[model samples]
Target chain A: MNKIFEVPLYAYERSSDQDAATAVRHKVIVIGAGPVGLATAIDLAQQGVEVVVLDDNDKVSFGSRAICFSQRTLDIADRLGAGSPMVDKGVQWNVGKVFFDNRQVYEFNLQPDTGYANPAFINLQQYYFENALVDRVRQLQAAGAPIEIRGRNKVEAIGTHDSHVVLEVETPEGPYNVEADWLIACDGANSPTRRMLGLDFDGRVFEDNFLIADVVMEADFPTERWFWFDPPFNRGQSALLHKQPDNVWRIDLQLGWDIDKEREKRPENVIPRLKAMLGEDVDFDLEWVSIYTFQCRRMERFRHGRVLFAGDSAHQVSPFGAMGANSGIQDADNLCWKLKLVLDGKAPEILLDSYSRERVQAADANIAKSSRSTDFITPKSQISRLLRDAVLDLSEHFEFARPLVNSGRLSTPCTYQDSSLSSADALNGPDITRPGSACPDAPLGDEFLLPKLAGKFTLLTIDAGAPERIEEGGVEATRLALSVKDDLTLELKRRYLGDATGAVYLIRPDQHVAARRDTFEENAFRQAIRRATGKE
Target chain B: MADLILTPNLDSADDFYAGLLAAHDGLDKSASDALNARLVLVLANHIGDADVLTQAVKAAALRGS
Candidate 1:
């Protein structure tokens, strides 16, 4: 077992709230101190909103769950001042190979079109990711930010009201009552908070189960994602291999339905399977073993009255694509700024509705992609399996069929093209960074563009003139002007400017493009800011 | 909209049919079905037009009915 899992990072401690006569009203109370919950608290606290995080456990997650973190997730983490540790400790890789029946079909490199500060994907243990977030929370606490994380503080019940939410929290010492003007639930799938509210989590539950084993060994396998379809060791089933820190190799083997899960997860059965795949001569130690059945599902709506849900509590996807944690961090990124605006009376509560609309769109996209990947990996019907195998067979010898062989369509940030918060595009820029698209990063001198646009609304002008600052309807956007001459690589021009010589873009606080034009007209830019802030 | 080429586009239709049958001559039922599926995918890639594929699928389905 990993040493990180045995230590309690956030052990229970007595608080004054437990001794108070009446319930203490906080500005925001977040349930579950997983990646999503900690991120929400940190973002809110960084923006000067008082937020409290409550979790039933006092430590990071036990296993190496959610190992693949996408580039967008790293970007968000960087803005929250927690990206450095994760990037430093993560095993970064972009190459993936797919195999069919013990033979390699094809390989792919997920290199981005242009340079980015973060890699395409990084494989790190979920414990390290959560520990990094918890460390960031501690730093913020030391800096006097209004953030609190209560360990072993479980919310037994919740009451939703018109303006406030009352939570009945149980601690190791005793039970206490608390009130919050707003409640955000990041409690993960099988969320107790969700059950307390009686909200239905509806979607397709895949019948097959996957046995995940994290083995520590000294091996010669390269640090790349290798997926096998029906290998000899696991006949008629798929398998995946990924490298993590501390010499831990995460192996996932498909265990078809109708097996005793307990028997399958035991070391007696699991060790033999590992030996068969990794030869009997190889020596290894098992770190963790478990079985999981993934479901691609989400709630009908994320926001309900004074309570809102983010991350797995609101949505889930199959584990193949690593969509679960990456999307959850994005949920926090999409939500925090709007929530801060609503809390400060700078924007109406309807601004939060756009969060639901946009994130639901993102969730649907993930679910669709994940479902298709799951079907390709585990075909339910005979004809479907035949078609899948045909693609795999043709892919080994042909280029066209390679695209059809879906091991897993890796996670990418979704673009909200139809968002109400985005204005119509007037500049014919590259579709990759058009209105409602996340801003692709470009090298500016020795620095990067995304870090400069962090945590605030920015007006990005390239050889275009705009005011230093524009404020409309209680929201302000500052200009960050850059000229084409500064971009020696011309990557900025290629990504943000196609044929247009000059352009101005209104960027949301989350770094998504809200609007763009050939030149900055004050009236249009002001209206764009208003629309982006949900004041239109 | 481009429709499926139901007309006489293939000049050596009988030759092509004979070649396909020869490819599947030694295969069992399962292997024959797999071969047919692979053929469909290869041809679909050759004719990559979505409208043409849709029309071809509709025409094939109507014949089956």
Candidate 2:
């Protein structure tokens, strides 16, 4: 009743007569050759840090694992010089349509007024993304900024000593011990690194199974996106379709609970359904089809001694918003600078704790958003479905009901509340632009505000004299006259005035507001700066 | 005077799209008007295309433009 299929391993193997166990010390040892791990490795290598990347997989697995990248991620990739080629291979999309029971209910076109260099989202398969990042890693290696990539080597154990983390990696030749200043585990959802350290990934796994199908078809399709509700694609099941480049498209069908528990999913059951939908005359072949159960979870802590966890190792989001990979990349972007500062001895070890605090906040927020998206997509009960349909109906008629229907709040960066770094005022209340918040993009000349904030931490204050006061407060601050574009008009001053004068704002390397001031006072600014940098 | 002709049993989505396209052409649609119509229609087709929809949804959800 089943056919045996053996997928060939595409990992690279080398014949080495040299001693394999010769302990080599690296500034950073990244475990995982996936996009996040590779992105981390490239950032470290670019900063002149010695690096090594190891993965169990032989080569990049072709799949629609993480096909959607955010504008923020595109900017990050641009900074690393991988954006151009990636953008070439990917499709830029900004429009979407949602159909509820064969009736169009909601629509959104990404008319980004925030003025970011990149558009709202770009689509590219996970495999091509990994290839691009791996290629970047190799380019860095060729430039003498060496990165040792061990494809077949799987990390077995990691022990952090006072100065270094000792890693026992299992290779074909046997187990080999290596040392690194820091060990980053981007290994993935079931991270062996996190398990080895006894870190618990606490969360919930959805009971539903989603069938993802990638097909190559010669049909004239729109460049926009559509999601159908309770469509008769599979009879009482929901289905989703999207257009991709290279004549390929992605399809997802909700396999309802009534499906045979042990149903044999032959090509016969799938192809006929496709033929029925698009007509049998349409030429197409199923490229890949897989079923995945979603999960929403985050680790108790992202850091254990010197070994750190990032990406899926830190948090797992449902595939609903493509939040998992995007959030993971954001984690890498946040942690890279702090790790660099600590490794270079520019900052103390206490700074590492902020990584856990801030990223865990982000991880939690992403999980919540993705979970909500998953819930919205797969209504668990009849009541839930009824409520959803009612809301959709309301949205169509009432102007005030659109936000409730669209649910666009999930896309905003999460404001950190539980982190120890924020001021009492920030932690005590809900404020949009507070300390520990991701400073929203400001307009600069013709470009959106973020391009100017690249590479270094920036502090934007309303009090023109606050930059000098911050210096006196023992904090490093760069005063900028930031013009934020609001509704096609550039507001050429700080959003708040007067009281924020001399109110010091400290920004982190990741451009998050590390600390902020409502009143320009030297001691308070100093204390906030110290807290942000972990000098306190 | 317009003749009222009713056709029954039209259910398929593809058939609907074809009927919609034909009706637009029957009106002798202008190029700019046709472009806007095609934009919406094509986008609808893409949404129903089956390969890229989920990514499109995520992309559509992006913050701040």
> Residue by residue across A405-481, what tens digits does model 1's lDDT show?
88777789989899999999999889999888989888887888899999999999999999999888778899999
Best by lDDT: 1
Docking class of 1: high
State candidate 2's TM-score: 0.77
Per-residue lDDT over A318-373 for candidate 2, one digit per residue giving the tens place of the 0 to 100 score: 66667777878877877787787777666678788888888888877776666565
TM-score of chain A of 2: 0.84
lDDT tens readout by residue for model 1, B1-65: 87788989987999999998999998999999999999999999999999999988988888543
TM-score on B-chain, cand. 2: 0.28
Q: Relative to the true structure, how large is the alpha-carbon lDDT of every model?
A: 0.90, 0.67
Q: Candidate 1: what lDDT?
A: 0.90
Q: Docking quality tier of candidate 2?
A: incorrect
The TM-scores of chain A alone, one per candidate, are: 0.97, 0.84
